[model samples]
Target: MKTKIFGHRGSAGTHPENTMISFKEAARVGADGIELDIQMTKDGVIVVIHDETVKRTTNGKDKGWVKDYTLKQLKKMDASYKFKDQYGICEIPTLEEVFDWAKSNQLLINVEFKTGLVAYKGIEEKTLKMINDYGLEDRIVLSSFNHYSLVKCRQLSSTIDLAILYMEGLYEPWDYAKRLHTNGIHPYHQTINKEIVDESIRNGIAVRPFTINDEKKMKEFIDYGCSAIITDHPKMAAALIK
Candidate 1:
């Protein structure tokens, strides 16, 4: 199988990370999929963002925890704060908005639950319902650093895909993944090697390393026969794959 390229936070190297524009750019560049993070708002609405605190991504005016703001309040801040001079203001996108938009394209969506820190009550159930409502189970992959959250998601839906996200080296992670009922692993790019990739693939587990932006490293992973690579520059990776 051809190694797939998934846009990390939607072509984060070029566009404002996690915004709709970033996602659209990734699709336009022929990325096989897009990876994004999700956190619940103060009003319990699921939104696409990477940080627990809004101070880093959003305009400084709204500086606080994401859980402190309602969806409406979050929409008011500019998520494109870092690139304001270039892209202007971009609102934080809701999961519903992303799902609705995703229907227009044939892009696989990797939704990473931001539950490693603040465990949003009932987030797994709520997110699963939204995915079902959008009828996107086949195209979606749910991943997280929290193994407990992954287990919860598996319990809620037997058919949906689950991937474990980890940063450290593991002794035969495929075995651990099997025990957790997860079929995929998204490891920190630096933590994966040829043996790990080969073993995981042999065991029918997908191996996709995250945030790989270096050209040489991208080529190395592709050569290792990884199922996919999550990268910040989808355009560059697509060019390489071609």
Candidate 2:
């Protein structure tokens, strides 16, 4: 089977990470899926951003926690100004906006919940409901480093696809996936190997390794038959695969 290429943070290497412009660039480059991060604002609106704080990606410094800012406050900051002016004042998009784009474009989205550090109390339910409202249950994959969050997501919606994200090597990852009732495992690129990829495939679990920017590593994972490779340079990976 051909390996899928998922744009990491919506082609983060070329565009401002997690912005709508970045996601549009990923789609333009022909990526199979787009990976993004979701976190709740103080008003409980889900916003697409990778970091808990907006300091690094936005014009503002020391903006405190993402959850502390209301959507109106968060939207005031320019998400793409730090990267380049060509991106043209990209705003941190709401999950609903992204869901609308994804549904219209028929693109697969891997929504990584930024719950590893702060457990946003009803994020799972809110996220799931949004996905359902958009009729995108088949196209969305909910993934997170916090396994407990994935479990909660599963408890809320059994049909939603869940992937466990971990940075360490796992033993019999497929068994662990079975226990969690997840459909996939997302490992840090450095932790994935041929054996684990093969085992995951054998057990019918998707193995997608993340943040691979190097062409050599991308080729290696493709050779290992990963279900997908999540990378900052989706165009490079797509060219190499072709």
Candidate 3:
């Protein structure tokens, strides 16, 4: 079977990362799903963004004030973040805003709990509630490098498809999944090879790679039967998949 394609931060290659504009663009280009990162704000609101700091994605003067600011304050900050001169005015999007966008579409959503100066506790429950509010229990997947978050989601909703995200070789993911009872593993794209890929397939564990943009490298993983790829360049991936 062909692998499913998810837009990393909503095809971040086209628009600024984590904005609804980017998600809209990804869906416009036929992405099967969107990969989103979640973080809790200072006011206990769940917002969609990638980095621990807002400075990277927003034109914030300070680096660590993302959560210190309210959701409205976050929206007021310009999200036209430029690293290499590519400009896009993307505002911060709330979890509800994203779910509203996904409600009537065929777009599957993967919400990654990204914690770094903030505790990810209760984020899983909040995310699950948001998904349920939209009646998208079957159309969304929740993943996290924090095994506890994924486990908590399972505790809250067993029927929810869970995926473990790992950056390093901390443990045998297949064994971890078996112990944790997760259905999928979403690992950093560069960490995979033929051996591990084959092993995942043999073990009946779904493997999806992250942030892959190189065409040649993408084909190699697809040839190895990858379950999916969370990518920055969905158009490139679409062409490669074709």
Cα TM-score per model: 0.98, 0.97, 0.92
Ranking by lDDT: 1, 2, 3
- For this target, which candidate reaches the highest lDDT against the unseen true structure? 1
- Per-residue lDDT tens digits for candidate 2, residues 181-216, read 999999998887799899898998999999899988
Q: Write the per-residue lDDT of candidate 3 for residues 120-190, one digit (tens) a residue.
A: 56777788887888899888878888788777788888788888898876356777886887888899887
Each candidate's number of clashing pairs is: 0, 0, 0
Question: Residue 55 error for model 1, in Å?
Answer: 0.8
Off by over 4 Å in 2: none
- Predictions in order: lDDT: 0.94, 0.91, 0.81
- The 10 consecutive residues of candidate 1 with the worst lDDT sum are 55-64
Which candidate do you rate higher for lDDT, 1 or 2? Answer: 1
Give the deviation of candidate 2 from the true structure as CA RMSD: 1.1
The residue-by-residue lDDT of candidate 1 on 1-242, one tens digit each, is 99999999998999999999999999999999999999999999999999999999988474899988999888888999567788988989999999999999889999999999998999999999999999999999999999999999999989899999999988899999999999999999999899999999999899999989999999999999999999999999999999
